[model samples]
Target: MSFTLAIVGRPNVGKSTLFNRLVGKRLALVDDQPGVTRDLREGEARLGDLRFTVIDTAGLEEATDESLQGRMRRLTERAVDMADVCLFLIDARAGVTPSDEVFADILRRRADHVILACNKAEGSAADAGVYESYGLGLGEPVRLSAEHGEGLNELYTLLAPVAETFEARAAADAPEVEVDVNEDGEVDADAPRKPTVDKPLQVAVVGRPNAGKSTLINKILGEDRLLTGPEAGITRDSISLTLDWDGMPTRIFDTAGMRKRAKVQDKVEKLSVADGLRAVKFAEVVVVLLDAAIPFEQQDLRIADLAEREGRAVVLAVNKWDVETEKQQKLRDLREAFERLLPQLRGAPLVTVSAKTGRGLDRLRAAVEKAHDVWNTRISTAQLNRWLTGMVEAHPPPAPGGRRIKLRYMTQAKTRPPGFVVMCSHPDKLPESYSRYLVNGLREDFDMPGTPIRLHMRSQSSKNPYKNKKKSTPSRLRKHIHGRGGAQG
Candidate 1:
């Protein structure tokens, strides 16, 4: 029994700030710059026992052409249409402008329910603007200061009735069913309750700007859910969507393209890059999209390395493959560059796809599934000990200063990137090369290619029972000593 509420208004009116407050996280990038938010981001919102979905949309503008602002405005309008109620906000200190009036008219016509709110009304500076909002002909405006957390109680009061109505409707619409019980007052064993299933896998799609990330996602969804164009840096927010792929539930995040730190001079772009990094951290598998014609650029390598460092299952997707004329040579070049430039992600699935034409999507999905499986792989203690024995025999650990480092036992400490702990003597003396050797063996022998493996060496000193006890002289020695003393006397 949940409904969606879209926070819509002109730019710099604190829509994102309010969104962050409602969702209890900084999911939306917030800055003083207008038009910073270019996509619709949704989150679960709760306030005073009320639960619903909240959407943060781009600022409403008066553009109507093919400009970026115009596209952003259209996207915001789509969010308004999907939302159950639209919270149209205006800067209380600045008062309502012509753009606000125009957008208010649009929301009045589009949204079935609308809640007018005047934000930034923390002090008397906004009093005049709050009083002037009555001229809009909508209802009373809720006084709010999103940054300072003011006037939220009034908002909850206003929304309680709407939430009640929704709950009642949902309860009435729910289907009714009957269950049978035996005379012993127990339910029939044949009618077992269904087991709960796990949530969908979280996969994030990320790369440099204009790498066809949005286009690839659109191809998968078979619709234009994400806005796409030839413009670079079109996507500014990391948008997540859920879908069913071949009977498997999967949630995918489309993140903003990452650029070199030196090249990113704008504040909004910095926030965008930070948002993309957050998405990678939140995701279980990360798809590093690359332009097929120019694969493995410095920025591309950085993105892949970042993913690997985050311990996410990595999959390389070379987009726009349909335009490549020399397929075999290009693929060979890609593989060579991948191996040479980024050995950290060696043997990771490098999938080539044409996002526009929807080519090789199946292979990409399969590779993602495989990478996730490998990332979550676990090995039994027996198997790990056996593997450790063979590895040590093949390449015994180095002994510095003639003191041999004893390798005792090995076991997997955890999964989800497969961490292992090896008990040995003189763990501090273990070299990095030996650790790499064991990790590579685990990857190759365990069929865990491209998955990050953690091997920890622990020092286990052998205990000596007699070392802590006081030593006593032997009886024979003591008797001999006494006899020697008497003979000397």
Candidate 2:
């Protein structure tokens, strides 16, 4: 079950800081800038023994009735409605302001459970503000320095009860249901999980600065809609452009160039890089544009690795391909370099195209679609089992401490990178080498090379199908009638 908790607060109140803290990574872009987080970003979070999803929302601000801020506020309110709880953060140093009071009123009127937190409360100076937050009527404020990782334990304790109650309510309200996945790969009324509306397929164009991200988008758009320049880091925020590719809705994002981590200095640049990463996370397909002059840099490999780890479909587009004289050699070298550098994304579709010259654009689109198709590929349980049997027979699971590992049933639990769950005797006892072998074998057998494959092993106890049935007894009346039968109730 997935329960969401949304973090809401004014701008620069360390909401993104706390968001990153809870999600256990830099999933949200954090900056001193007020509105760095314009979109509601959701991530899976773990607090103590509780696991739920958390959403980092845009800052609340006053806006004209028909302004962008109004729309953003509407979106934020919608996120709050979607969540099971709301964490309203206030700047401890600045104390509660008029805007905070307004937000408090809104939360109090709507939200049943609101956890107020005094952010940036590191020293005695914040004590007064923390006390003032009690006026909001949202119970005792959980003092926290989101940047310094303070007051999380108290926050967890407060959340545990709420989490438990939410879980209980969910279980009680949930319908008694069984799912039957049909052969057509579509879910019927009995399906386990039903997805929401399938929106446009997201494609992110990412590479070094001046790799023609905006130019690529402009070319595809056939207009100079996005700002293009020879300057680096020209585009800070990721801009999403929607279009139709063969009648299928597709959204392409033009992101800022991601430089090597060692060189990242300015606060805005850092935020921009983080935004690019978030775009990658949300994308289904990533077209890594490469400069013809300086292709296959270390940073490019790192970015590709990030995409693979995120289970995104990857397409390597060699931008400025028209300018290169040694086309065949460059292509070969690029392929060879990618194979060596990013083996996880090996065999990923590579196309040579000039975003400036509009050359090979069709091929780039075709490669992207192909990669997307591969990413969504799924295999049957019976087929997977057959392949598994063959693999174990050919090179069986290795044994450590003289105990042979017993791998039982295998099934593809989910698609979108083709995740499989294998039932084994001891999952933790399985060596990494053996796991890699099975994953590689699946990739090879299914002809899904370069597509990220996740194989998770679990230790499950087998159960008899008739374990729950009660034994029937013969009746005494029937025995009397039949003379030689046993007694029954």
Candidate 3:
């Protein structure tokens, strides 16, 4: 079902609270403060068995000017236009204010389907407000407490028909397959694990505050889907959106700016940083965005390092490249800095692009795909053994305490950040630098660049055959020697 449900209302109406309840996660950053959400965040939401894409949008504001609130309001309105249904939420405790009524009228005109909902209606204190919601002319409101998880069944009941339509469409759109029936009425077996077309490639853009992450995303999306402004730390939620990028179905994440850990003071900012880290974990490819003027700050390095440590494929993007005067010199300097600062992410793609001007986006896209391919690269056992043999022969493992560490065999243990298991003698004694040599060889020889490689050195756990042998006492040794060799000399 591609249908989308957007939650919209004035600030602090529990719209985000309800969004979290539906998505079954704290994907949206919820706070007591108003206007926390400034962008449209989409998640796979399940209300009972009815599955749909749910959007957590910025609060609908009274302002129509180009202020921050105004931009936020515009973003929410865009969500209304894009969604199949809009869940118009209102604060039951506060009653239906003028702002809520104004948004109600806007939804009436824009949204094809609008579902009126009064949130925080858990007790009798909200009854008056719940009753007052009927005056907005959007029909009887669904009273529920988003935080307490009440009235979802009623909400599911309303959305069931829409879900049914989704199922019907899905069935209708399913591609026809040629069935091969045998004499026993058995069908031919397909591939054990076929790729799911509906599953989009997950990519995340992460960086420091005001690094143009949202702007870069908007450029890729070819629309101002996210709220972008000059203010630092404007994005509080790790918002996700799905789009078709150059013939590839991709789900992109716009994460909050991650500043230095000690500098993150506000509770909401901390939550936002946590949310971005979650997004990094969930993503297959992470684009570490950098401002062209200040390419590799400490925070930027930390974010990139975090992605690398997470075993995610990384693509380095220098945003606002169009504004850089010394393009060649800056590119060379950026590469050197990247190598020095993040040796772990060595050989990763570092493309320059201007998010504001949409320049070099094609190259950025190519780099991302290339990095993903490298991340998922797998080598055959025979090939890996050959490569390992060559690597060991070229520069053998070091000898410590007169015992040389021997690498006996090598095989790929897994892919998607390719991991290898090396069967060797005295694995514990093998130096880390030798492991780096093997990993670097694997990268260069197998053409797996910029992907995090996990090298596991394993030694057999078998015990020595004479481990339980009894030691000879002094008397026993003397008796044996005397009995065997008293007259032999």
Q: In what order do the candidates fall by lDDT, top score first?
A: 1, 3, 2
Off by over 4 Å in 2: 1-198, 462-489
C-alpha-based local distance difference test score of model 1:
0.89
lDDT of 1 at 471: 84
Clash pairs, model 2 backbone: 474-487, 474-488, 475-487, 475-488
Instruction: Using TM-score, give the best candidate's number.
Output: 1
Candidate 1 vs candidate 2, lDDT winner: 1
Candidate 2, residue 111: how far the Cα is off, in Å: 41
lDDT agreement with native, every candidate: 0.89, 0.83, 0.87
Q: Is candidate 2 or candidate 3 better by lDDT?
A: 3
Q: TM-scores of all models?
A: 0.89, 0.58, 0.88
Give per-residue CA lDDT, model 2, range 379-420, as digits (tens).
Answer: 788998898888889998877789888889899888777799
Model 1 alpha-carbon miss at residue 327, Å = 1.3
Q: What is the Cα-based TM-score of model 2?
A: 0.58
Which lDDT value does model 3 have at 322? 84
